[model samples]
Target: MSKFIIITGGVVSSLGKGISGASIGKLLQLNGLKVNMIKCDPYINVDPGTMSPYQHGEVFVTTDGAEADLDLGHYERFLDVNMTRANTNTAGSIYQTVIDKERRGEYLGATVQVIPHITNEIKRRFTAFENEVDVSIIEIGGTVGDIESLPFLEAARQLRLEKGPKNVICVHVTLVPYIAVAQELKTKPTQHSVNKLREVGIEPSMLICRTEKPLSLHLREKISLFCSVPTQAVIECADAKSIYHVPENFYKQKVDEQIIDLLGLTPKQKVDPKWFEFFDKAMTPSKSVKIAVAGKYSELQDAYKSISEALRHAGMNNDAKVEIVFVNTEKDNVEEKLKTADGILIPGGFGGRGVDGKIATIKYAREHKIPFLGICLGMQCTVIEAARNLCGLHDANSTEFDPTTKDPVVDLTPQQKNVVYKGGTMRLGNYTADLEEGSLARKLYGKDQIVERHRHRYEFNPAYVKQLRDTGLKVSGWHEGVLPEIVERTDHPYFIAVQFHPEFGSRPLRPHPLFDGLIKAGLKRKENK
Candidate 1:
C-alpha cells in the first residue's frame, strides 16, 4: 500500500527533472514520511560503469557498489539515503534480464514481445523496492518523445493503472523559454510538451516549469489550461544562486501542498521553513579561498561535478566563498599555475593521459610547501611522485602504467591472483577506513573509524610504506586489513590523499572531512599570504 510518484520531462532533456524529483522527495521526508528514489535510464549500456567521463560525465557509485547515473548521486545527497544497484535500471539492464530469463527457460517457451516482456521487466524493477518505503519517487530519464524511453514510460503508465490512480502521481518537468528580444516568456513549448506526454497514456498530476524569470499568472493559467492541470499545480522553478535553495523555492511555490493533495495524504508534521534559514546562514560568505584543481579531465567541468559540489559544501560549512581554479595539468607551465592558488587538488581518473603533468604538479606543490589533496589515482601519483623525488627512488612508477617496475611505488593488488580489467569491477563503493589517532584525518572527522565510497582499480602498495614514511610521508590512515588506503605527508602544512572518493558522500549540509580540511588549509595559506 505504498504511494508512488513518477517524474517525467518534456520539451527537452536536462530540465532538472532529477533535482526536482529529489527536492520533492526531500520535502516529503521533512514532513516525517519515509521516501525512497529510483532512476530509469533509456541508455542501452548495462550501466554507466564502462562509459567515459567525456561521454556521460562521472559515473556515481552507490553504497552497495552500483555505478549509477549521476542523478542518483543527487538523490542520495539530498535525501541522505544510501541507494543500491537495485534502485537503478537501464534499457540494457531490462533487456538483459529478459534475455537471461529466456536463456534460463523462465519464460516457458513463449515468444516475448515489447509490451508484456520489456514493460514487465521495467515494472518489476520499479516495484521491487516499492514496499520497502512509505513512498517511492521514480524519475524516468529522457524526454517524453524519446523512442528509447518508450518502454519505461509505458511501464510507468501501466503501473499507475495497476496501483490505482489514488496510489500513483505523475509529475512532469518542462521548460519555459524566455526570448530576450521580445521580452516575454513563451508557453507554447510547454503546451506542446504536455501534448506530447498526453499522446502517451500518462497525464501529469503536476507541471514543474523551469523558467528564468518569475512565472506570471497569465502564463501559469495558459500552461494549466493546455496541460489539463490546475494553475496552482504549475510550479515555477526559477534559477537560484545555489541549488541548496531549491527546497525552499519549491515550498514557496506550494509544490508540497499540491503533492499532498494529489496523493490524498495528511501531514503528520507541519513543514518548517526554518531549514532554509539555516542553509542561507551557512551560504552567507564571510571570506574567500582559491584552490587549484589539477587533473586530466580539467577540460570538462561535468567530469568533476561531485568534487566541485563538495568544495562548495565545505565553503558553506566554513561560511566562506570557495573559488575553484581548474588547472589542466596536461598543459605546459604547470608550476606557474600551482604557484597562484592557495591549495592544490588532484582528482581521480583513469589511464595515463596527463599523469606526467600531475606528477609535475605534485612535485611543485611538495617543493613549494603548498597544501595538497589527492584522491584515488591522484593519491597513487602523489606516492609515486614522492618516491621518485623525495626518497631518491629513481625508478618509481605505478604498475597501472608500468607493469614491470623493480621498485613500483603503486601497484595492483598482490592478493588478486589474476590481472584485473577496469570498468564496473573495481574496488568500488563504500568501505571502512580506520584513522590513526592524533592524525589530521582523525581530527577532521572527530572519529577514529569512518566509511567512504571508492571507485578505483589501483591501490597503494603496502610494501613501499616503510620506505615512504622514512622519507617524511606518513601513512596517516589505512584499511583495517593489510592494504593501505590513505597516505599523508607529516611535514607539509596540509598534504593528504586517499584511495576513496569522499566527494560522492558530501552534501550541502554535510561536507566531507578531507574537503573541509583542504579548504581550512587553504584559508590558512591565504591568511599567511
Candidate 2:
C-alpha cells in the first residue's frame, strides 16, 4: 500500500502548495521511491477547461486528455511524471458520479449526503494509486475554511483512520504575514489556520510557513507550541529566486528526512547528484536573451505559465537567461512591441481576442526574418497570415473567428465537429507526427517520427495545403500525413509553427527541441546584429 501525504493550504491562497508538494515528491524520488502527486480541486467545475485563464490560470492537459488544474503542470515539470485523468478530481466530478450512481440505484434507496457519499467518493479517488506508487502526495485545493473544501478535508481525515496514522501524514501550509508597523512576523494567523484545520478533525503532522524571511527560532518554537507540531516539523518556505530551488531548500531544512522518519520508509538511495547539477545550471547561466510573447493575456502572466517556464528551461539548457517581454497586442503596437526582440513567440490561446495583432506580429517576424515559434493558436495564425500575405488571399482567416470567411485556411478538425460540449472535446493529449526527411523540425528533433502534445480544435485546412505549400510554406510534418502538425519555411532562418503545445512536455533538464531551437536561433540573430 502507498503511504499518503495530504498537503492543504490555509491563511491565504496562492501560497505555493503545489510547489511544496512537488518538492517533497522530488526528494522522495531521489530516495529511490516511486512517488506520484495528485491534485484535488475544490471547485464545482467538472474541469478547468471551461474556466477563463484569468480565473483559474492555464488548463493543463495531461497526456490522457484530462483538462486539469495548472498545478498538474508543476507536478509534471518537477517530478517528471506524466499525470493521467485519474490523477485529478473535482467536487463537480465527484458529485456527478455519485448522483449518476444513485440514479442507477447503486446506493439501494439510501439517502445521499455529503458525509459518507461525497467523502467516500473522494477517498476512493485518492487511494486508487496505492497499488501503483510507494508514496502518493495529494494536494487539496483551496484554503481550510472554504465551504467547497470541507468534504475533501473530511475525506482526508477519514483516510488517516482507514490507512492507519502511521501510513498517513498531513502537511498544512499557512501564511506568516509580517506586520509593517510592528516589524515582526505574526504567528496568530498560523495558529488560527491550524486551529481551523483541527476543528475540522484533521491535525497536521507538519506545518510549512510561507514567509518573506526565515522563521526565527523563537517563531518556530512558538508555532510548534501552538500548532502542536514539533519544532523541526515547522518548515519555512521563504521566497526563492526560482521555484527549482525549492527542493534544495526543503532538503536543506531536512524536510525529506523528517517525512521518511514519520512514514517509516527506508531509502534505497540517499542522494541525487543530477538534481544538484540541474539546479546549478539554472542558477548560473552564461548569457541572456530577450523573447517577446505576443498574446491576448499578456496582462496576466499566469495565462501562459507553462510556456514561460519552458522558455526559461530552454535558456537554462543553452546557458542563457531568458527575459520575456510581454506584448499585449490589444493594447500595445505589435510592430514596436516586437522590433527589439531577439525572437518572437506566440503562445497558445483561444477566441479572436488580440488575434489580428498576433497575426501582424507573425507577419513582422516572417518578413523581417526574426526567429519565430508559434504554438497551437499561434500556429493557426501563422498559416492564416501566410495564406493572406504570401498566397495572395486577402481575406484568409479561421472559421473560429470569421465563420463566413471565403478562404478558411484554418478550420475545426472533422473529428471535432460533433463535440458540442466544450468541456473535454478537442484534439488533445499526445500524438505522433511524421517529420519530413530533411526539415528543420526533423533536424532539431533528430528523428523522423516524433510524439507531441496537442490542445486545439482547429487544424491546418487540408484543402488550402497545396496553396500554402506552393507559396514557400513548407509542410514539414503531419499526423499520419492527413493533418498538418508542423509547418515551416525554407527561405527564413528560423520560422516554424506546430499545431500542438510542445511547451507542456518541456522539462528543466531536457528542454523541448522546438523551444531549444528557437532560443539557439535567437542567440545567432543576437550575435549577427
Best by TM-score: 2
lDDT of 1 by residue, 130-156 (tens): 768778899999999989999999998
User: Could you give the C-alpha RMSD of every candidate to the true structure, in order shown?
Assistant: 1.6, 1.0
lDDT of 2: 0.93
Which stretches in model 1 have alpha-carbon errors above 4 Å? 414-423
Q: Clashes in each model (backbone N, CA, C under 3 Å)?
A: 0, 0
lDDT of 2 by residue, 1-529 (tens): 7999999999999999999999999999999999998899999999998999999999899998889999999999999999999889999999999999999999999999998999999999998789998999999999999998999999999999998988999999999998888999999999999999999999999999999877999999999999999999999999998999989889988998999999999988978768966876678787889999999898899899999999998999888999999999778999987888999999999999899999999999999999999999999999999999999999999999999999999998777877889888887798999999989999999999998888889989989888988888878999998999999998899999999999999898889999999999999999899
**Evaluated with lDDT, which candidate comes out highest?**
2
Which lDDT values do the candidates have, in the order given? 0.87, 0.93
lDDT of 2 at 64: 84
Question: Backbone clash tally for model 2?
Answer: 0
Task: Report how far off residue 504 is in candidate 2 (Å).
Answer: 0.7
